[model samples]
Target: MSETPLDPRLDEDPYALQKHLGFRLTHWDVDYARLELPIEHFLMNRAGIPHGGIYATLLDTVMGYAGCYTGDPGHKKLALTLSLTTNFLSRPIGHVLIAEGRRVGGGASTFFAESTVSDETGEIIARGSGAFKYRKTRL
Candidate 1:
């Protein structure tokens, strides 16, 4: 049997197109993916706090990527966030932020994931849970 080569998209920085959006894919396998994002001025709301949408986006991206890890070879899957609930636990005041996500349940076609956004000091600023559906594409 031959080994499948790594997907090139995985090497492309997800945040390269978004200004001030920095993300690092720390770990990923067939069933999981973990990423981190930094909190910058562009990600803040009017109150000088990290915007809720930013948290939502980060959660969605990380969780979606996790699902993609379980998809078939050469078949890319795009995940759509069907529902998401976020709880703001604390204010993140720092130069950097960290976001981690993991698949909690479900399968390759659909799944639920949990994510947390924290400051550099490891204080959680927001927690999120979301349901996503995966669509297989023939790209």
Candidate 2:
């Protein structure tokens, strides 16, 4: 039988809350991570596309998680976003969005990662790259 993943909702950090509300980390490895978010009224902007901020948040979360996956399994690496640059490529019109993140460089203390958000049909909606500082979580 497949094992169920632990709930990230129990996390007390605000950043964790934001991530849980948008997308749950579904896949992870040493080099890649995947996440997904549902598109609802709350996620929309006045222009009717998914808000740019939502895309930014999703990208940041995925990239950070990707970095964490590269760390030792028992040591949880929490990442703080240092800088993020996003390029919105297309307007997304879907009920769900997917994000895939991959590590670009660096190691345990600092890292660079990039993520791309796309709609169900595989249209790229946004792409982002960011620098993050990784630290061990306090016991």
Candidate 3:
């Protein structure tokens, strides 16, 4: 499969958890983020389906990133999730899973975001929403 061109910032320094999950940051922009993951055996459960925790992790990560876009790479933005909710809609059927997130609304210090996980067929398998607090950055 041809690899998707990802945002360069993703390679700068990813957290260990992100690397371990093996999801790629395919896109990022103002109030938006998109990630993709190839289904792997290790990510499946005993029932041979992707684990629920994996879905939650992807949802949280994407949503948080949706609100973290800073036009300037040097000025990084971070957010701490205050609350997160994931709703599994259906089981996915495909070799790859795609997650997309969008920032909804909030003030400067806090924000809200929503996300969905979809299969290669474009069927949404999971949905999520979250509230986050912007972290203070050192001047």
What number of clashing residue pairs does each candidate have, in the order they appear?
Answer: 0, 0, 0
Arranged by TM-score with the best first, the candidates are 3, 2, 1
Which residue pairs come into collision in candidate 3?
none
Candidate 2 local lDDT, 2-100, one digit each (tens): 224434542334456665466766666675777778887777789877889888888988898878763444456678899999999997766678888
Q: Record all residue pairs in model 1 with backbone atoms less than 3 Å apart, i.e. clashing.
A: none
lDDT of 2 at 16: 60
Candidate 1 has an lDDT of 0.71
Per-candidate local distance difference test: 0.71, 0.77, 0.88
The TM-score of candidate 2 is: 0.80
Cand. 3 Cα-lDDT: 0.88
The superposed Cα distance between candidate 3 and the true structure at residue 10, in angstroms, equals 6.1
Best-fitting candidate, scored by TM-score: 3
Q: Per-candidate RMSD vs. true structure?
A: 5.2, 4.3, 3.1
Give one digit per residue, the lDDT tens place, for model 1 in 1-139.
1234435555544555443577666665565666666666777799988788887777777777766673454555677888888888888767677677778888757899888878778788888888988776534
Q: Ten consecutive residues with minimal summed lDDT in candidate 1?
A: 1-10
TM-score of each: 0.77, 0.80, 0.91
